[model samples]
Structure formats: structure tokens, C-alpha cells
Target: MFLAMRAAVEETLAATLDRLGYPTDDLGIEQPPDDIDAVLASSAAFRLAGEAGAPPPKVAAEIADAFDAADCQYIDRVDTQGPYLNFWPSEQYFEHVLETGQDDDYGALPDRETSVVVEHTSANPTGPVHVGRARNPIIGDAVANLLDYAGYDVERHYYVNDAGRQIATFTWAYETFDESELPEPERESPEYEMVRYYRKANTYLEDEADEAEIEAAEAEIQSIMQGLEAGDEAAYERVSEVVDTVLDGMYATLKRLPATFDEFVKETRFMRDGSTDDVIERLKETEYAVYDEDAWQLDLPDIDKNLVFVRGDGTSLYTTRDLAHHEWKFDNFDEAVTVLGEDHELQARQLKSALEILGNDTDRLQTVHYSWVTLPEGGMSTREGTGVDLDDLLDEAIARAREEVEDRLDDRIRDDDLTEDDIDRIAHQVGIGAVRYDIVSKQPTKGITFEWERALDFEAQSAPYVQYVHARASGILAEATDGEGINADQAVTELDSRALDTPSERELLRQIARFPAVIETAADDLHPHAVATYTREFAEAFNAFYRECPVLDAPADKQGARLALVVAARQTIGNALDVLGIEAPDSM
Candidate 1:
């Protein structure tokens, strides 16, 4: 309803401005400040004050006087306070919000008819995903979900880094190291099992082995890389097997985070299929390309350093291969969003600059650079073999969540009998939801420390808090009519906007009305945290209404309207959680 009202307000305000003999290009409609006590406001008068040859307050008064609130869709009246034009919603607006909230597709936007590829969490297939880099997958998946909800056809992708030196080192370790020297598997998973080879190789090179052994190890790794790039089919097949084994383990952990990819594009494919060579050849002809220090480099615009695409040995760098990968993405999808760590910002800019120099449209590609996720101990490094594994973090989350669930079970036993299976399922949902929400709820540019206390706080601003509100509303609805619950559709039909008169009820109605607009803004800005913020606000509004407004014990005519409000709040909260890829359980 907010989206519809905003559009109507814009159109109506533009007409009013045109009548006042001022430009109507940007009316500067904005949300009113807290002290203004208005649903929407505009500061266009300030922008047009010079042209109108009058003060902003006078111009605002003139526009408000000319505005026809009765004709607008949801706006009831407009007032000029100081230099601002504040607009309030009509009773008809509340009626529409209550009726629409009961629908299953409450916050979904109209299809935009664009297809997008979201490439994220392309962590090296060397070990299980760790908490340090977990932000990539969580943010990437949530962004995809937002796009999908925004009506874009989105395909999630993981660009497998199989052609890098890391792969060569992992392969070398698996094939060269003695089986007797490898440690026993910790978790009986392929990722856990295969990473030992890489870790052992790293430990030997960095700490244990002598200089001669290190030289031999590095030489063998160099040979494997050369062979892979030189199109040695046997070497390619062998390394591919190791990569697939590790990926199996990685996928197991990703599934627990509930992140899935529609495509697993191998970087080696670009090398084998001549796409990498094609990229190098194109860069060689560009004006920015220069042969310096026995390597081909492109002097990027506005940057002091040149981007190296080819090394002294003639092996193309990862950036060059990434160019080929992006070209593939551009060919197949209308747009692509790549998620990367803050450390990769330079590489991303270089890629775009090189793409521009190649005469390709670089606007089709977008990059979201996020800071690292740290622990109380410090940062993590897969190479150094230090960091909390994603599996371990999730395992501990579930165990801790189980204790919370057990305590809640004892309190609610008289109302609902939960079996052991129910307890376990609820534990997983809350645990995973806490982790996902904790990471995705923060601004992508900021780093976060994963804490169970904050994430699982039932009374605080967390996923469990939001989920518990959902369960509370469910309990209220279920207790009505002897467990049959009020028929939400029927209640919506009989909903009376006049009966929803209390301040708390009005606030909740306002929050429910803003759901569609919140999603649209988040989708446009590529910010998933916006929806998370909205969900928290919506939950708070519902809690206030629960405290002040009676649902089942309301006056006879007000009962159905209050029940309908509950239904809408429950559905909107659930839908918001779904957009974040977090489950909204019916019970706590």
C-alpha cells in the first residue's frame, strides 16, 4: 500500500507542481521525521524556492493548497508544517492493507522480465567452508533471494577455482605425500578428509620440512600447474577428481547453511576451451595493453598500477581467466552480480577497466565487496589451517539451540505436546536461522563476530525473537474457535478499519502497509539488510499490538478486524524471513 500511495503521491504532486509553474522532475518525496508525525513528506519546496521567488514555507503551503488528497489512492490529507508537505494515509488505505496481508504472495513484486546470474561463495575447493569466509555465501544467497522476490529470474553460481596454484598444490599433496603421514579423518567427510592433504602439504612446507624438501615440493607443484595449463589430459583428469572430492564435502556444509548453486563453473574449462586464450588475445590488441617485464599488462584508467594478464612463463593470471568467465556470464544472462571479499576490490576494478578497454559493455557486471567475518580468537586462513569450520559452528549452534528449545518445551507442554523429533527439527531451524540472520542482517560493508548469545536471544532483536513472534501469533490464532482458528479469509472479508482505532493497531497497520515498499527498495539497492531491518520493526509493532489490543476478547464487531490484523502480521513476518532464506517456524 505504501508503494501504491507513493506512486500516486508522486503523480499528484507532479501535477500540482506543474500547475504552480515549477519544474516537476524531482519532487523530493521523503519519509517524515519522527517529530513531524506524518506517514510521508516532501521537501520539493526547498528545491524550487529559488525558481518560485518565494520562501520554502510559502511554496510548500501553495503546493499543499493545490494538492487534491481526495483523488489520491491512499492519501487522506496533506499539510504544510514549516517547509515540509506531510501526507497522512486514509482509512481506505488501512482497509486495503488488512485485506491484502492475508494473501500468500503479500510482498512479491511484479516480474521485471530480466534474468540475472549471482556468482558467490566461489571459495577454493581446498577445504570445508569456514566461518571466516561464510559471509560470501550468506550475503550472496540473500541477495539472490531478494532479486528473485523482486521478480528477476536469478540463477545462483559458484565459479570453481580449479586452475589456480592452490589446486595444483592440493593435487600435488594428494599424489606425492605418504599415506602414513596423513592424519585420520576428523568427521568422515570428503572435504575434511581431502583437506588434510593440503594442510599437511602446507605444514610441511612452512614449518616441518627442510629447505631441500620444500624446494622439491614447490617444483612438483609448479610442474602440475604447467601441465594443467599446457592441456595435459591425464594431469587434468587427476586434479579434477581431487577438486570434485573436496567439493562434495563443501556442498555438504553449504546445504546445512542452506546455500545452493544452480551452476558450478570450473575455471579450468576456460583454459581448456580456449576462452582464456581468447581473452589474452583481445587484451593484447587494446590500447591499454603493454608488454612489460616479460608479461602483458593493461594500464587501468585512474589507477597507478598496471593489471597483469599474462605472467613471465606465459601462464595467464586468474584475472584474465575471470574476464573469460564474465564474458560467458554476459552472454547467457542479462546481468551478473559477483560477491567477493574486501581484498578483491582492486581486482574487481581492474576487471571492469579491462572489460571497458576490450570494447565490451562493462555495465552489465556488478560486484558486491564485503568485509571478512571474524571470531573472538581472530581471523582465519585456510592456507594456515586455522579457522572454525562451518560445520563445527553449525553443530554448536544446534546444540545450544536445543537447550533453549528444551526449556521452552517444558513451559509450553500444557498447551502443546512436542515429541523428540519436533524438538530436534525446531533446534535445527532456530540454529540455522540464527546463523543466517546474524550474518545477513548486518550491512555487507561491515564485519561481524558470530555469537550464540546475541543470535539466539529470545527477547532481543534477533531471528529467534522474530520467529518467536510468529509462533506467538500462531498460538493466538490457534486458540480461537477451539483450535480451528479464526478463518482468516472470512475475517478479512468482515474486517472493520474503524474498529482498529488504538495507537498500537494503527502502528501495526502502518508497518504492514510498508512491506511492499521495503522489498522494492531493498531489491533496487541490492541490500538484503533492509528487509531484515523491516522484519524486526514489523515484529516490534506486532508485539506492541499484542500487548495493547485484544484479539479474542475484543468487542464483538472489533474481534474479526483484530484477528485479520494478526493474520497479516504473521504472514508478512513469515514472508520477510523467507526472503532472507531463513525458515519461519509455526512454533518456538
Candidate 2:
């Protein structure tokens, strides 16, 4: 929706400069700062100020004059600010900004339409998902959605490490321990049972009661894993049972969280299909890999750590499976994205270098390490069964959201109006939104200390606030729908501005019109937080407008026009939410 306007603006600027005898190619511009009230701003003329051998203010004034002389019909006024120039939209231009985007192709970009694969939330299937693991999918799903929205043929994937020792231990511990297996739920966390068993396994190992017994258990697990890797029919089926069982419950919790993957790749598949060996050979043949002491290692070119890809026994490590995985992705997608936590920075970076080592075009694959902030409380370790379990976190978020809503609305909403269905819907929206938006509201590189007050604040840029704005827009439209809704081609007046006469109204229009640009920026940077931040900007603008501009109580013709404006604003915001894989319920 914004592509056309951007092109038109740039083209008009270029044409205006060319007609005025300035070199258009050398001149560049950017959208004005959001904090400012200007329509457009740039310092292009600043570059030529010294060449013109005149004062910067004089140069800026001349360029501004030249731009104003151009026949572009959308701009209201142009002003010079020393070396910078600014453009302000006329009220008519504000109306045009709404109607202007009707035919705009905002979503699709030139980089889209080719299939891209993103592997995210590929948690060790030993236990439930954790808060750290949640970051990957929260970001990955948004990335995939952005790519798709931007017109890329995209696929979301989860690489299951079903053959890993972690799974073997988890399965081993589960089968060996019966009713007594569950650990003491001292603190009663979400993963109380799982954590209990994990601690039990460690405790058993630490006791050193019987070396033979412990060795026997290890051998049994290895045999099972080896069988699955070697395509043993029974072993594969057995492993699948465990995977299916955990995945069923895991996916259930994830569904509530609302992130999904289209494909689930198994690490064992590499072993069964012999691709893992092929990748190992390719790495060894090239000078990219070397036999280091006993293990197979990537050279890493001295810029980073030499990565261990395989053990001396030829057992595949995470890096080995990843090498094979990248080969698969390169053959399958035009782009591949890896959203992982910060702890694996070295390993993930080495994985990319390993791909470059194994004869794949480094340019063909774009690997992004979307590192997330870890809770300062602790980190999750399989052996210790520690960290924040995602299932538990989500449950807590929902419970908190429910309590918050029910706490306030209990008196107003009677037994007849407030039902399970309504509560669930609201809780889910706010709970999930709170989680997603919490991280998304900040740059991913920045750490977040989870705070309940911030997460559930309905007045903050948190989920509830934005969702409330969406609901408010709907309520206004509901009252107007009795006889109002502008026809498809209804004409709007220059004076109407849709009751957009206040500072807030102007701000709202600017924000509504800026949605496409914001989305494009977010997509380009692979940053969903940009979109999140924009949602708050838009919501704040809507609130301010709501507070000052009387949409429903304005002149009837003007009120109807303003309703149309609100509809467009709501639509644009909804679309933004959709791009983030969020739902803006019509009634919130």
C-alpha cells in the first residue's frame, strides 16, 4: 500500500529537481521523523550546499521552492529548516492519504514469492517448551508472516532432535521410574512433574550406586538411538510414539501461544538417508574441516571458534545435523532463517560458516540469529530440568490476565454476559498478546525483565492497550452502522478531513497513512518490534484523536466521513496485526 506512494514521492522529487536543473540522482530523501509533524523531511540539499557555495539555509530554501513548484498534488505545504526541508500534508492531502492507499500494493516486495524456510522452536523433546524457546517462534512466526505478507513463499519448520541423548535420558528416566518418578513439587511450578523427574535422574546418577546399572542404562539408550538412526523399523516406531506423545501436549500449549510450524524435520532422518555422512565427507574433503585430535571440527577461519561437528566415534552432534539441514534448505528454499537464543551465538555462527565450507553458495542462504533476552532468574538445562517452562509461563500469563479482567469487570458483567467462552477469548487475546508484545515492543537485542504490571497494563503499549484500541474503533463504527458507512466511492470534502482538524486527528491520519511504510521497514529489518512499536504509536494517536476529535458527534456528513476514516484506520491496524500473526478481533 505504501510502495506506490513512496515511488510517487521519490519520483516526483527527482522530476522536480531535474526540471529545476539539479542532479536528481545524487539527491536522496527519507520519511520524516515520527516525533515531528512534517509530512516529509530530508537533507539532500545539504550535500550540495557546499557545492552551491552558499549558506545551507539558502540552499534548502531553493530546493524546497523547487519541490513546491513540482505538480505533485498530495502535499499541502513545504518548508525549509536550515539544511533540512519538510513537507506538510494539506487537509485534502490527509484525505488523499486514506483514499490514496486504496489501490496500493503494500505487502508484496520484489524479494518475495520464493519459498523460504525458517527453523524455530526446535526444542529438545525431552520436556515441555521453555520461555527462552518461546522467543524463537515468537520471532520466527512473525518473520515468516512478514515474509509471506511481503509476498514470499514461506515455510515454518521445527527440527526435532529426537535422536539426541537428551531425549534418550528423558525417555529412559520416564520408563524406569513409576509413580514415584515425579519429583517433589516443592515450589509447584508449571513443570513441577518434569522438573521433579529431571532432578531425580541427576540425583540417581550422582549417587553412583551401581556403575554397571548406570552403564547398562546408557547402553540401552544408545542402542535405541542407534537403531532409530539406522532405520530400524521397531526403533523408529518406538521413538515416534514418544515424540508423538510429547508433541501432542506440546503443540496443545503452543496452540494457545499461537505459533506454528508447517514442517517438523527429524535429525534421525539425516542418519537414515545417509545425508549426514555425505555432509561429513563434503566438509572433510574441503580444507574447511579438519580432524582435530579425535573429533571432526570446522576450521572457522581463525575468526571464531573451531566448531566440533562430530565426535571421534562418528556420532553426529547438533552441528553435523545442521550441516545436513542447511543442504536440505538450500535445495528447498531461496532463503533460510534460523531463530535461536543468544547462548548458541558461537555455534550458530559457526554453523553458517560450515555451510560456506561445504560448497553451498553463501549468498543463497540468509541465516539470521534472532537472539532473545533470557530471564535473569535462570536458564533452562535439560540435565537440571531448570528454566521457565513455556507451558507454565503461558498458563500464568492467562491466569493473570483472567484475574485482571475479572477483578475489574466482575461487577459490571453479570453471570449472563460473562461466560467461559468470553473470558477465554479475552484472556487468550490479552495473555498471548501480552507475551508477544512484551518482547516485540523492544528491540530484540535489548533484554527484557518480565514484569506483570507492564505486561498486563491496559493503558500501556502492551497487548491490552492495542487490543482495546481495536475494540474501541469497532464500538464507534457499531454506533454509526445504523445508517452510516461511506459508499465504496463516496466523495470526501477538502474541509471534512473526517473531523481530522485537531493535532491528534492529524497525528492519527499520519500514523494510519504511515502503516505501510512501517510494515515495510519491519519486514526489511526482520524486526517485529518495529511493528509492535508502531502499533503503540498508532494506538496512542487513535486515543488522542478519540479524546479531542468528536467522530460520532461531528457534522453528519463529516461524521460519516470520519467513520470512513476510522474504518480505514481500523483496517490498516488490523492488517498490521495480521502481519504479526496477531488477531484484532472485530469486537475485541
Candidate 3:
């Protein structure tokens, strides 16, 4: 309803401006500020005041005077406040909002014909994921969820860096290092267990290995890289076994956070299938290609630095292989989104420039660059073994969440005879939700200092708070209908907007009405934090309504209306949480 109303207001504004001989380039339709007593506002009057040779207040009044709200079903009236043109929603609009908000699929947009592929979390397969790099998968998953909710055909991908030097180093460590050499005790998971070998090997090379021994290790790693690139069956099989084992453990960790990939693409595939060579050959023919210093390079006009595609030894760089992968993505999907860390900003720009020089459409690709998630103590380094592993963080979060859940549900556990498994399940949900929310609720460009208190806080703008609101709404509906055979759906049919007469009721209704608009905007802008912000506000609005207005205790005629409101609020909150890839529990 908010989107529809905004559209009507924009259309009316455009027509009015054109009639008044003013420019309509900027519609300036936006939600009014908190102090404004309007549903929507347009600042186009201010934008056009310069051209009209008049003050903004006069221009706004002129536009408001000439505005036509007769044909708009959702707009109540248009008025001018200083330099702003504010719109109010009609009673019919309120009724339509509540009526439509009751649908199970209230927040999803209509399906689009476009297909999108989201590639993210392509961490090196050398060790376990740490909390510092946890933002990648969390943001990637939520953005994919937002795109899916916005009706795009979305596919999630994890690009395995199997052809890189890091994989060779890990494979060498796997074959060379002894279990006793591990710094810590062996872990049950392969990612955790094998990382010990890699760390020990790195430490030995860094702190104890002689020059001759270091040279031998380097030679072996080069041999492994060449063998993998040349498709040697023995080397390929050995590396594949280790990579798969590590990825298995990594996937287990991701599953706990509920992030999954539709595909795992190996970088070696491009090397073996002649795709990388094809890319090099194509670049060699381009006007920008430069063969200098025994290396193949592209001196792009717009890029400050030259991109080297081939080294002196004739081995292709990761950037060259990435070109092949992006080409394949362009060939397969209508659009593509790649999530990268802030360090990759230049590479992302270079990739687009290279693609454009190759005559492929670079406009179809989007890149989201996010800052790192550092610990409160400091940043993390996997090679140095001085970071908090994601598995351990998750374990700690689950333990803490269990303590919190026990505090809230102790009486219910005793009275309702809840099983241990039930508590475990709820704790897992809350813990994972808290972790995912902590990473995704901030703007991607800003770094986050992950703190346990902020992530798991029950009273603040955390996932637990939103989840609790959902559970509370569910409880209200359940109690009102317990043994009465009056479900929320039945209350929906008799819902009347006029019955909800209080200011708090109207405010909550307006907030609920904004869900669809929020989804559309967030998806278009690739900002999942916007969804998080809207969900928190929605939760607060519902709480306000709960306090100021009673559902079960209302007058008989208004009781059903308020219950219908609860039903809509519950579904809206659930939908918002789902977009953030967080679970909505029915019970606290």
C-alpha cells in the first residue's frame, strides 16, 4: 500500500509540474521525517524553485493547490508545509493495507523474468573460516535472500580457489606434516584438524626451517601448482581430496548459520578446460594488450596500474583465471553479483574494465564490497593462528544463547515438560540468528567490531528482539483462539480499519504498510541493512501498539479488529526476518 500510494503521488506530482511549466526530472518522493505529520512528502517543489524564479514555499503551495487527488484511491489529500509537499493516506488506503497485509506472502514482489547469480565466500581452502571474515557469507546470504524475495531467479555460488598457491601450500602440508607437529590437539572436523598441519608447516617455515629446506618447500608447491594446472590425475586427485575434506567442514559451519551454496566452482576448471588460455589469447589480440618484461599485460587507459595476465614463467595469475570465470558467468546468467572484501575494490574495477575491453556487457555485473569484521581485541590472521575461528565463535554463541533461553523459559520447561532437544533447537536458532544478524545489520562499507553483548542483547536491536516480537504475536493469537476455534484467518475476514481508532493503532498500521516498499528498495540498492532497520522499527511499533491497545481485552467488536492487526504484524515481522535469513520462532 505504501508503494502504491507513493506511485500515485509521484504520478500526480509529475502531471502537476508539467502543467505548471516546471521540470519533472526529480520526483523527490520520500517518507516524511518523524516530526512531520504526513504519510509521504515530495521535495520536487524545492528542486524546481530555482527554475521557477520563486521561493520554495510559494512553489510548494502552487503545486499543492494544483494537485489532483480525485483519481488516486490511496491518497487522502496533498498539502504544503514550508517548502515540502506532504501527502496523507485516505481511510480506504488504511483498510487496503491491513486487508492485504494478512496474506501469507505479504512482502514478496511479483516474479521477474531476470536471472541472477550471486558469488560469495570464496575463502581459500587452507583453514577454517574465522570471525573476522564472517561478514562475507552473512552479507552474501542476506543479499541473495533479498534478491530472491524481490522475485529474481537467484543462484548462490562459492568459487573454490583450487588452482591457487594457497591450495598447493595446504596440499603440501597435508602430505608432509606429521600429526604430532600440530600446534594444538587434533579437532574432529577436517577443516579444524587439517588447519593445524598448515599452521605448523607455516610456523616451521617461518621460525625454524633452513634456507635449503625453504627452497625445497617452494619447489614442491610450484610443482603441485603446475601439476594441478596441467590436469595431472595423481596431483589433481590428492589435492581434490584435501580440498573437499576442508570444504566439508566449512559447509558444516555454514549450515549452522544456515548459509548454503547452489554450486561450488573450482578455479582449476578454467585452467584445465582451455578457458584461461582462451582469455589470454583474446586479450593478446586486443589493442590494450602489452607484452612487456617477458609478461603479458593489459595497460587499460582508465586504470592507473597495468594488469599482468601471465608471469615470466608463463603461468596465469588468479586475476586472469577470474576473467574466464566472469565470462562464463556472463554467458550463463542474465545478471551477476559478486561479494568481495574492501581489499578487492581495485580488482573489481579492473575486472569490469577488462570485460568491457573484451566487448562483453559489464553493466550486467554488480559488486558489493564490504569491510572486515574485526575482533574487539584486534584483527585476525589465519596464517599466524591468531584469530577466533568461526566454529569456536558459534560454539560460544550457542552456549551463551542457551543460558539466555534457560533464563526466559525455565518456568515453561518445568510446567510444560519441554524436552532437552527442544531447548537445544531453540538455542541453536537464537545463536545462529544473533551471529548472522550482527554481521549483516551494519552498512557493508563500514567495518564492524563484533561484540557478544551487542549481538545477543535481548533488549536492543538484535535478532533475538525481533524474533521475540514474532513469538509474542504468535502467543497472543494462540491464547485468543485457544479452544475457541477462532483462527487469525477467520478474524481477517471481519477486519475493519475504522474499528482501530487509536493513534497507536494507526501508527502500527502505517509501519506495516511500508514493508513492501522497504523490500523493493533494499533489493534494488543491495542493502540488507535497510531491511534490518525496517524490521527493528516494525518490532518497536508493534510493541507500542501492544502496550497502548489491548487485543484480547478490547471491546467485543474491536477485539477481532485488534486480533487481525496482531495477525498482520506477526506475518510482517516474520517476512522481514526471513529476508535477513534469520529464523522466526513461534515460541521464545
Candidate 4:
């Protein structure tokens, strides 16, 4: 079934035909028509027959004879009808390839330390994470996993914005609440509860609020940020204390969902090390910086926006500090990408140009804007503390999913048997899988409105469906009395091509063959959903095949072949799911 390997086989065929004097260099290969008996059809010899003053039928027969004598074992029959050469997979090869992926790297690229540092899950340290930040790590982790599988040196990192004014509000609000009095259960999640603390602080400030206090508070926050950036030991210690309190709670939930980072780049460190200050002076020397209103701005005339670099008060703009950070990444790796929300479009461009202004290499710095559309909640704001906490959503998902699983199994077991901790882990897997699947399944540019049912459903094109399929395969493999686990012999077939004439079986073969190609395209485009979509399609095909062709009770040869097909399909779907940051559970 090398012909099922499609493109590569076509090129190989074209070269052979060309050497055999087919009077055509346009010899191409294609899959058979949707319902056709042949695996593929070629038109080159037929198309050039008239020019060569020969009958196309006779020319096609000659080409078919050449292929028949070749190394490929799949094509059993080659027939010419007018200007076409059609080849059908020999039954043996077709069934053999079904149980195994072809012998190629499956388009896996090599790692020469060609690294990508992905900065993701940079939720502002003001409150707990929510669906808004959910897609960030889902997408980031998926991309990271895909890059690693494709042989890239990928380091996942988080640029924690703990030094910003947002943290000041988080700290100021927590102090207002004296949250120490809260019950242990509530106190366990200081980050999530900080929203209430923020609300109390805002209510108190509302009575005495004015532009002066607002500006004064803004200045104090900026001062804190600068001190943290400037490596002021006292400021670092103070801010880290408050930030860590919330960060600890936040990290606990993030770890539960498994959003990890190789490094945590503190925004304060970017300033404290004088990197931003150094970048600004460098920009000034290159005339990229201009003094306006006693504030230095990075001139972006070509893009028609004068980006503020350093304020009139001599503090760095977000863009200036970001420039220093990117420079740091460029020094460390050959490439770096960012998984940011769509709101950062302008910021991305400004950051890149500012890097250019600072005389840093921007070409090797690859930036990916892994954007997600926010649901209609007026977006996350640190002051109001209104967006839903991701932990809450995860907690709810875990409870619901565990209930669903229990309902399906051990109907008589007491609820006590499912301990809170047991339900927590089960929920963590299904809940996070649901959240991750919902985002990864959608197109990156589509804006989403949060819907609970859509995130958790097993019948829909969601994580549950794919995970169930994997579990199904595991179930079948478990039932086997220690048959040789799927190995290279999936390439050996006991079934015939005529047996695969049915539409569903053909579709399964088509999808299995396209696995390598689909991944190659996805990796090149950095579109994780490509893999997501493929997983669904393959699963659908398998389901269809299952309904039509019973696997477990078939004849010995047929059952074994079907099991091989199951193994291939399961492995492929698992690989695709991994690239989308979804897990394949052994049991539903």
C-alpha cells in the first residue's frame, strides 16, 4: 500500500514512468474516485497518447505492466480505459497497511536545538484564572507538545506580570479584607477569594475617590513596579510576599490542570536588571526614541503610532520592558514564540518594532499570537475582579464529570466510596480535558461565548468522544490473551482489497493513510486544530467501521486484521489528541 502513502508513491511512480519513456513528464498520481474500485488512477500516458501517435489504451497497458513488475505489492491490477491508468491495491497490502502506519517518520522533523520558547499562561496576578486564560495554556501546551513530537527544542515559559499595578491592587485589596479570619476551606484559595477583597477595597475607595487619589495610587503602583524592576531588594521582598500568597493558590489549581512552565520570568527582574533602561538608552542613540511632553517615546512613523517608551516620570512603558525580555530570549534560543490573547495584536507589532529600534535581532524571534475570543463578560479587569475563576469552572467540571462516570458504573456504590480527593483527580482529567478540547477544537480566530454543556458533552466533537475511543481500544487490547502487541507486522495483511470495497472501510483507510500528511501540514501551519479535526474524522470513520464490520467475532484472520486497524487508529487518534493537549483515558 505504498500507493496509499500517496504523494511519495506518486513521485516514485512518476520517476519510473519517465525513465520508461511515457512521452510525458506530467505523470501524476491521485486517489481513486470516491466509489471507484481502484486505489488510484493516472492520466499521463493516456493524455500524451495522441501526441506520441499511439493508442492511449496500448500505452496505458505498457505503463501498468511496468508498475506490476515494480517493488510495490499493493497494486494487483492495472487497467487502461482510454486515457487513464488505474491501479487497485492488492488485498494483502491494503489490509496489511491498515494495521500499521507506513515506514516513514510520519513527517517528524529533526531537532538541531532549533528551539522555541513559548510564553503562555501569563494571567495577571490580580485574581484566579478563568476560561479567558484557559485556552492560552491549552493551546500553548498543545503547540509545545506538537513541537516536541516534531523534534524541536521547545521550552515552555510564563512571563508572570507580578510587578504591574494589577498586583498592587491584589495586594492592597487582600490587606483590606484581613482574610486571615476566613474559614480554612475558603482561605485555601486566597487568589480566588481576593476578588471579594478587591470589591471591598473599591467600595471603601469610592467614598473618597478623586483623580488625585487615582493618579496618586497609579504613581505608587508604578513606583512599586519600578523598584521591583530596579532590583530594589526591599520592594522585591515586599511584592513577592503578597504576590506569592495569591500565586501559591493560583499555582495549586494550575498544577491541577497541569499548566507548567520551564521558567517564570518576573517582570520586575526585567526592570531591576536595568534591561529596559539599557534598551531605552540604546534606542535614543539610534534616534528611535524622541522626547515628547518631557516623556521619551519610541518613534514608529512607518506604522503611524508614537509608542511611549519611557514616561515623563522616567518609568518604562510595557513595550520597553518587553523589548528587553525578547532580547533576553533571542540571546538564549534560535527562536521564541508567544501565545497571547487577541487583545495583544497592537502590543505584538509594537514589541517587535521596539526590538528593531533597540538593534536586537527580531528575525530569529518568531512570535505566535495564540488568540482566544473572550465571552461576553466585558473582559477581565483587575479592579472589578468579575471574571469567573478558572479553578471554579474546573472544580464544577470535575464534580459533574465524576458524577457522570459514577452514574455509568457501580450504580449501587455509596457516594462515600467516591471520596472528594478521588472525584477531584477524575474531575481534573475530564474537566480540564473538556475545557482544553472546547478551545482547541475551534478555529483560533473565532470568538466564543462560554457555554457549560458544550464544554462537557461526550456526544459532541469534544474530548470525551476521542478519549472514549482510546478507552475502547484499550478494552479490546486488554481482552486479548497476550497476542503480540501491534508491531511492524501491522504491515502484513491477511485481508483482500475486494473486502474493503465498502464506503466506511475505504474511508478508514483514507484517513489512516493521510495521518502523516495531516500532521505535517499542521506542524507547518502551527494550527493545532488541524490535528483536532483529524481526530474527530478518524474517530467517526472508526465508529462507522465498527457499526458495519464487527471486529471481535470475525474470522481469525479478519479479527486479527481489524484489531491491527484498531491499534493504528487508536495510536493515531492518541497522537492527534496529545497535540491538542487532551488526554486519552483508559476508561470513559
What C-alpha RMSD separates each model from the true structure?
1.8, 3.6, 1.9, 5.6
Per-residue error (Å), model 4, residue 127 = 1.3
Worst 10 residues of 1 by lDDT: 481-490
Residue 175 alpha-carbon offset, candidate 3, angstroms: 2.0
Residues 178-214 of candidate 2: C-alpha lDDT, one tens digit per residue: 7565646634333344445545666776785399988
TM-score of each: 0.96, 0.89, 0.96, 0.80
lDDT, model 2: 0.71
Instruction: Note the Cα lDDT for every prediction shown.
Output: 0.88, 0.71, 0.88, 0.68
Candidate 4's displacement at residue 306, Å, is 1.7
Residue-wise lDDT of candidate 4 within 380-466, one digit each (tens)? 544555566677667777777877666665634335344556555555677778777878878776777656577777777877776
Residue pairs in collision within model 1? none
Give Cα distance to truth, residue 45, candidate 2, Å: 2.2
In the range 1-588, model 1's lDDT, one tens digit per residue, is: 778889999999998888879998888988788566567899999999999899999999999999999878888899989899999999888899999988898998889999999999999999989998899999999999999988999999999999888899999999978878987877899998898899998888889989899899889888888887888898799899999999989998998989999989998889999999999998998888899999999988897889999999888888899999998888899999999999999899998888888777988888888998887877777766677888888999899999988876665682566777878888999999999999999999998987789999988878898998788888777777453435544566876788899888988988888888888989888999999998888888899999998887777778889988888898999899999999888777
For every model shown, the clashing-pair count is 0, 3, 0, 9
